[model samples]
Target: MFFFERAIAKQIKNGGGPYFRYIDDLFIVINWPVRHLLKQIERLNNFDENIKLKANIGSFTNFLHLYTENRDGTLFTAVYQKPSYEPYYLPSNSIPPLHMKKNIPFIMLLRTIRYCSTFQTYLSERENLRMASLLNKYPNKIIEQQFNNVLLKFNIDQPLTINNYNKYRQNVLDSPYKEPTGIDYDKVLFIHFTYCSSMEMFPLKFHTLWSKSFGESPINEITPVLRIRNVKNLQRRLTH
Candidate 1:
């Protein structure tokens, strides 16, 4: 596929246009008739038997989850969602830890900030996220707190203006996220136990016990990763 894309890109370059390819997705721009571009794409399609290319020619299109349009010599971008997409997330009222519940809204709010080109669009997406969170039994306070945190992260304040949004969006695009180095298993300990509603504070209690037992020892340097396992009920016990 790499070689095929390179060959097709070479062909596209001969016609003097900008072409970009990302994991089987292509974005091509040319100052020629649409029919001419289509013919060129068709020729490229014939270059390989396994790779069949389809062209989407339009002034506005969704590419890589972004709805972009060329409007009056300017480009406008917004987050795009397919018609079949549903807003479903982990229920805040579930048995997960409080941090995980808070993370649901925090991550979504960050995504909304990343993908929305304007503040107005981001506000609309935030409202949608709030509604979805409510449907999932999430507290409204958590959603609002996360939203405010995102605004603070981006240095956005009340009476938001397009200039602020444009600056924030540009800053985000210029500095794409780099995935942080994952946990060091060598420096961690895994502790697992059966989970119950009453054991919600087990982690904190365990930490306190550890500090009293080994606070001065080298073992204290190792992080303890606590995990919970759901205990099976009578129905599942019989089935298993």
Candidate 2:
């Protein structure tokens, strides 16, 4: 992937438009004629037989899980879910640590805030999450509390408007403080754990073991971040 990207970087850069690449997905913002854009895409596709590219061009496009639309020269974005997306979340009745289960709502609410660029978009996504929570058997009051928690964390006291959304959205990214100054660490490791309904105690056990092994290390500190999976339905493949 690296070599192929390096080989085509110049062609893409010189093609005369702003382009961004995340892994194999490419997003290009162009104001040229459609004919010229197609020609450039064809040229990119022919760069390497092994490295084929699929291009979609329009005023609206889905990139990096956000639906971005250009309306009268202004850009609007909202969270995008594929057609096959399922609304499954960690079951509220699952046998997990109480805190983990309680955090489900907050984690999801944060995502809604982060992805929905407009106030209306945020409300729409929040409604969808509320419905999904109902299907998952989560209590309505719990969901409401979670919503309030997210609003408080973002310092949103009034009704969410486009201006407030933009302000607090940037604040979420800026809220985390930088690592304490003057602390030196030889190595840093970011460990991620996936949650499974069947293995409720796995994360707790893993953390306990990890602490016993590395708690006395010379590292200044260890921070744990819990990430909730956006996609809950797992597709299984059979191998012969």
Predicted candidate 2 versus true structure: per-residue lDDT over 34-87, tens digit per residue: 787688678767767876765676678897778888899997888899888899
For model 1, the stretches where C-alpha displacement exceeds 4 angstroms are 1-33, 39-52, 155-163, 168-179, 192-196, 227-240
What local lDDT score does residue 141 receive in model 2, on the 0 to 100 scale? 91
Q: Which residue runs does candidate 2 get wrong by more than 4 Å?
A: 46-52, 158-240
For candidate 1, lDDT tens digit of each residue in 1-240?
A: 877777767766987888987777787766667798789778878977877777777678786767888788887777788888898888776666777778889888777777787788887987898999999998888888887776677566653466677776676567666799798988999999887767889899999999999999999999898987757877669988
CA lDDT, every model vs. true structure: 0.79, 0.74
**Superposed Cα deviation of residue 220, candidate 1 (Å):** 1.7
Query: How badly does each model clash, as a count of residue pairs?
Result: 0, 0
Deviation from truth (RMSD, Å), model 2? 6.5
